[model samples]
Every structure is written in structure tokens, then in C-alpha cells.
Target chain A: MPLSKAQLLAWLGKLDAVYAAKKEYLTDLDAAIGDADHGINMNRGFGKVMEKLPPVADKDIGTILKTVGMTLMSSVGGASGPLYGTFWMKPGMLLGGKEELDAADFARFVEAGVDGILQRGRPERGDKTMYDVWAPVLEVVKARAAAGDDVAAIVDAALPVGEKALADTIPLQARKGRASYLGERSVGHQDPGATSSYYMLETLRDVLHA
Target chain B: MKKLINAVENVVKEQLEGMALAHPELTVAFEPTFIRRADAPVAGKVALISGGGSGHEPMHGGFVGKGMLDGACPGEVFTSPTPDQMYACAKAVDGGAGVLFIVKNYTGDVMNFEAAAELVAADGIKVQNILIDDDVAVKDSLYTAGRRGVGTTVLAEKIVGAAAEAGYDLDACAALCRKVNQYGRSFGVALTSCTVPAAGKPTFDLGEGEVEMGIGIHGEPGTHRMPIGPVDALTAYAAGQIIDDPAYTRTVREWDGSGWAENTLTDAPFAKGDNVIAFVNSMGGTPLSELYAVYRKLDAVCKEKGLTIVRNLIGPYITSLEMQGFSITLLKADDEILKYWDAPVKTPGLVR
Candidate 1:
């Protein structure tokens, strides 16, 4: 089945709640190596996205996603702002005027969004950034779609790969963002950006399954 | 955190409100949160706009006035301001001459300001963005996001603002600003960690007798921690870091009209016989008297190194929100830079 605009909205709503509930957890992770505001930034960004959703509720998925991206870009005042803002905005630009996305279309959307993240952050794999999680997850998404899996199955198959990638980030020394300032000390701490990306994927899975 | 703030969310807004009430010559906008001089966009003068996280007071905002910045954008505490704020402030402050964005080298600040520059350029307004990265503590630009922009930012704003006031065009103003960044170096030490109001706890913990050396403005851990000692020893250590720092090269992104371009820049080491502007800055909570003590040793150190101090500024000009520490900045000034440094500036945070 194709993923409807309603499912996309539900995924964003679930993300808002997930970030709100995990704000302190993410902040604590960031406190270990970063400036300790990831939770506050993500929660605040999603809150702004929620406010912008009602206005674009009846619009195409591209418009709704673009609104979320713009709101986050303007509201979240951190590196994540532009990083994640482009993540959604690029996909929105590619998916312009689309109201529903099938498994192949959704896989392409994820691929394009991850490309945006790469272009904006210039983060390589093993850099202990959100790209670590996204890179592996994107691979799984592309493979599952090529295998004729449904949208729900694609997301389900990608979540465990993402979770493992997030865990693998704990041993890698950061080479980008504020965490890179820690050098060797950045090891042994799970990357806050990867963890947040995992939560986002997990939220999508729940929305798809429901 | 035991702060004077009424709520975590309203901290930046409330403080900006109080600043607006105090400085009538400046105008504060809340919707996008930017501060500008009351009489901005002076006919043919180039507009200077700067911004960063809000906790470092008397910086971008407090320096907005005649002979200084035309506009300032304040982000959340230690967080960069959004691009929309920069675009709006640039539009509001740009005179016929164009706008120059003085951005620090933090990842967020650099990206946001870059985005804003693109927006402004697309609108057909002439724009240029210059980056300041003077902190000497961070060694490699290959791994981390270069050196954090520190005390030199204040000095750059004053010097570049004066140049703009003296009829420097967009390219000239940007070139001079870049010169200031290359000519300056800074190093900081923290006595204690600070609490971000939202986090409600200290960003890091330091033992009673330990100090974080090579610290940045943010409360993150520094290069290393050492046993706390007398004032003179710490002052010499910071001064030594700046004086002894080797030449550094990094690739910086510049807005080239239509898109971004990588520009490689180098910061040369300070040498003997170089005339310098010695700045002793408090990290918010340090008393002025303690800073004087720091300066007392800094002066002797500069003399010992054969560097001449033509001008000196001592106080909490660029701070870290009561973090109980201080940083030392040494700018090797040339004739032109010295002339602009001596120019008149009137703002809430600085007056000359």
C-alpha cells in the first residue's frame, strides 16, 4: 500500500511526542560530548512543525513536508537546523505535488533526503553524526523496495539496521560538529544526532504499522 | 539552575526587552528577534550585521550603535540564530551601500549566516560574509570545526564598523575584517562550569582545585584540566598560548554572489616588534579587579616577549555568562588597523 499524507502527518505527530518525552535523554547524551542542547533544540523544532501542520493539512505531502522543514530551519537555532531542514526540504522539492508515495517512491524520497544531509553537513560515515544512522538505513530502504516489499515492510526492515548503526557510533571518535572538540573522549558515548535519527525512524515505523 | 529568569523559554525575550528599554537609541524586534540601531541604514554607509548565541552579552547586540554594528541577531543561549533573522535584519538595516555579515566560525552560525547571505543575494541586495576564528586552543582544522571565534569578534566589529563608517565598500570592509581575524589570537581558562537555564545544571563539572585550560566561551570541556594556581601563573599560561601559537591554515566558505566557494586562509604567528592591542576580558562572573590582576601579568609577559602594546582594553567585553574565568586576546595591529581601532564608537557595551 502507498503511504498516504495522513500517515506522514501521523508520523510527524508521533515524532513530536517522542522528542518531547526523550528531550532530557537526548540532552544528557549531548551533555557528554556536545553543548548539551540537542533535546531542547529538537523538541522546540518539532513543536514549531506541529503548529505549521494545521495550516497545510489539506495540501500535498510536498507542501506539508516543506512547511515542517522551513519551520525547523527558522526555529531550531543549531547545526541541526540546517542539517535536518535540508533533510526534509530537499525531499519536499523532489516530491513536489505528490499526495501519496508507494514503496519505491518513498525509498527514493529517503535517498534524496539523505543526500541533502550529506551535502549540507559534509559528514562521512563513521564521523559519529546522524549520517551514520541514515547511511545504513537508506541502504536497507533501497534494498527492500527493490525486492518488492511494501512500505511498512521497508520501514520495518530498516529500523533494526538503524538501531545497530546508532549503537556502533558509541565507539567512534567524533570528527564533526561540537562533539569533535572532545577528540578521543568523544568515544564511548553514543552520538546524540544518531540517536535522534533513530527515534525518528522508530516513529515512522510505528506510524506505518499502526 | 538558580537564575533570575522567570521561565526557561522567555529568558532571551525578557533580556532583550530589558535591553531595548535601557538603550533607546537601539530598536529591538521580537517576531524574529533582532536588534538594530535606531538610526540605521545611514544613506551610503555599508551595513554591518553580526550575531551569535545570546549568553555572551554586550557582544553583537550591545555593540549595535553609531560607529559599530548596524544590526545584531541574538540566538538562544549558546545557540546560533536562524537564517530568517539574519535575512530580516539585513533587509531592515541595508542602506544603498549593501550589507556585510560578520559571522563567527561555529558550525551553526556559519551555516545560518551563509543561508541568510544566499537569501539576501537572491533579493538583489549586495552582501558579503566574513568569518572570525581567533581561538588558538583548537589545534587542527582537519578534525574539528576550526577554532571557535572568541574575543577577536568584539575587536573586529569595532575596527570594521569604523572602516564602514569611514566609507569602506563591501569588498574592502570584508577584506579588513578578515585581516583582523588573521592578526588576532586568543586563549581562555575556566574556573568553573556554567549552567544553561534550560538544562538546569552545569554543562561540565570541575573539581575544587582544578581549572579547565584552553576553554572556549561555551562551558564544554577544554583541552585539559590542571591544578588551580595563583593568578599570575594562569595569566602567563594563557598569554603564552597566544604568543607561541604557530601559523594555522584552514579552508573557509565564502559567499560568491550566486553560491558558496571554498577559500583557504592562513593565520600567521605573532613575532617580535609587532604592535599589539592587549585585551583582558572577564568570563562574566570574574570581577574587574581580578581582571586587572590578570592584566598586570599580561603586560609584563608582552614586554618580556618584545611585543609592544599600543592600546589595551580591560573588562568583560566578550563574556560566557558568569562562567568564572577570563580570556586573553592579542591583536598585532598595523597602522591602518590601529587608526580604525582609535575611531569613536558609542554603544551600550562599548564607548570611546
Candidate 2:
């Protein structure tokens, strides 16, 4: 029922691989409504995080996460840099010195990450941004955690919700970020940030199963 | 993707290297790339900093030197620089007087600069971020990212950078920059979309005779597209937006030494008999002859409207990396602005 730092490191490594394999696909999705570098930038950021993660693998979860945050902030050059970097950095700060995380800690971690993103980007649900996924996905995460699920079940439960949220990004007009430049034309394209968010949760689910 | 570079990833690095080699007065630092004046941290003077995506060459970087930006942070192609770069650049150039950040209104640039401002202030350096939203095409900020900062940024940098060089305090320089921005309006049209090296293709597609109106620097799909028209008609259309724009009221956030302060500002419409600086800027691909042609039409329109082009900048001052387009910026220059504009500058892009 507990997720160890080892598993967290493995999850990060898996994320590095997943982003590397799917970088072009992500960029393709972004090409529809936004600039087509979401995948490349994410891959580059996570790749750097992976290279930096090894030295801190023995540290507490918070330290590991903060390292990833700093790596992404410096390596990534787009809105994703600060957004995803904050997502990790906030959870890491809250979970400092912890050797492992239980369901409550994991739920609070996701919640803190979402709150950090909200504070940084100021986006609301249906803005056709990553927030569109985070709002509903957080609801799912909180419900699963409250129901006494472990990190695996909580993340497993949240994966489909995140994917659906990604799909739902279609038909929504963007009101934030570069996609807003397209206005009504931004509809019918899956938000790239939402897609990456889905991938992130999906990576966690795969880590749990492994 | 036929480019002059030997490799795509090395574009920014090689450019920085070339800049450092060519200009002995500038210092280009990699590993979180930033370009600062070789004589940075000029004591007793306010330090000016500005940057954005790298593709808009000769902008934040080329303008970094004697009478312009004290430092600049260049990001990936058409992408905003990260906060750490800005923070490092600010720390490298901050005089005891303070530092002023000239930021474009794009979401990434605004967020990055805001984050950097907080980080820099925590390190005990005074910081103020002045937003430039002079592009009049977006129409509304409630639903959009305000107006995209374009040609007006060029004018702001030159004007405010001179003020800083002339010993204005941080608050006074920020006020002058804000005034310059409020009085400036810009509009641009694109004959072709720019091809980012990373994207490996044009940002958007255009037909043989199609043209995009109200195009932003990043090749975002524009307000409208129409059949290609004569240069005179096209220039007139873009000029009309800047000239006839009604008073626009918007709220922007400013850093007031301690925390963020929200200031609601309004821009008055351009009136007759105004003395102005008419800037005709290329989007990088257009040659000077075409720019002059656009300016030729812009001059006629201003004359008919009773506006005088007392000074003008005609060239690829703020470009979109070989995107075949041009933008026009007109600022009602007061005596202070004109005097500062005529101040001695020795940047790679501008020399006076």
C-alpha cells in the first residue's frame, strides 16, 4: 500500500522513456492548435531530470522532486517549464524528508501540485488548458484517496479520467496560452498540455503495474 | 528546411558565439544563455533588461549594449526564456540603482519574467516589470493575452534604455517606458509564415495569393486571411487599425518593490497634428525595398490624417525570423522621448 522512493525514481525513469518515445506524437498534437514543440520540450526537460535524478536517488522524496523541478525549470524553455516544474516542486516541498508516501500523502501531493499550477498559470477549467484536466482529475484523485485506496489504485483510477479530460479538451475554445491565438479555431484539437498531463498519469499507472 | 546553419540545435549557441566575437563590448554567457554588456553592473545607473524568443533576432540580444538593454536572455526559437536565465541575467547586470524588465505580453514571457522578478527581489535587487502590448490587432485582453508586443518593443527599448543610461532612477525609467508603450500602437501583415527550425516546416500554410492580416511574431494564425493585394492597400489596412483604434482600457500588473500592484491604464486614440515616430518593420524575410514601399504608403496615410512623421525607423528592427511580413508602429513622441531617441547608442542593431 506504500510507494517507496525507489518506485518514485522508477516512475521518473519510465517517464523519461515514455516522453522520449512519444515526443513526436505530442508535438503532432500541439501542431494542430499551438506551436509544435510541446513533445520535444517535455522530452528534453524530463531527459535532463533523469540525468540529474540519479545523484539524488538516495535522498528524500522531497529532495528528489525539487531536483526534478529545478532541472525542468532550467532545461525547459516554454510555459511547460514553470508549470510542470512547479507541479513537482510543490509536492516535493510538502513531502520533504519522507521515505515513502501513503494514499493521503499522495492525494495531498497531487492537490498541492495542482494548486501550485493554478497559482502560477491562473487558468480555470474549460480554459482549454492543462487546468481542464487537472480540475476533474483532481476530483478523481481526491475521491480515490478518501476511499482508502493506495497510490497504485488512486493513480490507476485517475488515469482514465485524465485521458477523458484530454479528449474533452477537444471542442473547447482556448482562452489561455498560445492556443488562444487561434480563438474559436482552437476547438476540435486536443490540448497538448492536457495530453502531456494524461501521459504523466499514465506513466505512473504503468509504474504501479510494473 | 534550408537554413544557413550547419545544425538546428546549434543555432542559438552559434549565434551567441558570433555576437560575442563580433562585438567586443558585449558578453555572451551560455549554460542558461544570456547576453550582457561587457561593462555591466554600471554603478549608480538603473540597469535595463529585455528578452523573449530567439527567432526575433537583433531584438533583445542585438539591442544589448551601450544605450539599450544591460542584458538579454534568449530562449529557444519563438519560445520565451526560462526564469532562471532572466534571474541570472538580472543579477549579472543589476546596478545598485535597480533593474527594470521590459517584457512582451505573451503568456510565456510574462509568466517567466514575473517569476524571475520574484526570485530577483528575494535576492535583494529591486525589480520592476513593464509590459508592452502595443499590437492593436487582438482587440480585447479579457479573452486574449492582450495585444502581442511587436514593433513597439523596439521603440521602448531604445527610448527607455537611453533614459537608464542618462541616470534615471528605476521608477522614473519604468514610468517613461510605460508612457512610451501606451502612446504606441502596432499592426502587422504576413505574406508567409515563418519556418521554425525545430518545427521543420512553416508555422502555417498560405496559398499562392493568400495573405494573413494581423499576424503575430510567432506565426500564430492571424485575425483574417485574404487574397494578396497591392502593397499600398495592404499597408493602408494595417495602418488603419493603429490609427483608428478607439481608446482601449486594460489592467496590467506591475511590481512595486515589495509585491505586485495592479494598474488600470487606458490608451487614447491617435489624434490629428500629433508628432510621431513611424516605424515600418520587416518580419525578417521581406527586403528593404519592400519595406520602403510599405513605408511609402504609410507616409501617405499619415499625411492624409494630419499626423507628422517627425522621426522614423524603417528596417527589420523587430523581426519574426524570416517570416515574409512587416509591422508598423507609431508613437506620439514628446520632447523627452525625442531627446532620448536622439541619444548616443552603440548596440549591434542600433547606432546613433
DockQ of 2: 0.71
User: How much is the TM-score of the A chain of model 2?
Assistant: 0.97
Cα lDDT of model 1 by residue, B1-352, tens digit: 7789998889999999999999999999987989999998788999999999989998989999999999999999999999999999999999989999999888889888987897899999999999999999999999888899999999999999999999999999999999999999999999998888877888788999999999888787789999999999999999999999999999998887778888999888999999999999998999999999999999999999999999999999888887999999999999999999999999999999
Error of 2 at B249 (Å): 2.6
Model 2 chain B poorest 10 in a row by lDDT: B139-148
Clashing pairs in 1: none
Best candidate, DockQ-wise?
A: 1
Cα lDDT tens digits for candidate 1, A26-141: 98898888888899899999999998899899999889878888888898878989888888988898888898999988998899889988877888998999999999999999
In Å, candidate 2's interface RMSD is: 1.1
Clashes of each: 0, 0
What is the docking quality class of candidate 2? medium
Backbone clash tally for model 1? 0
Give the whole-model CA lDDT for all candidates, comma-separated.
0.92, 0.90
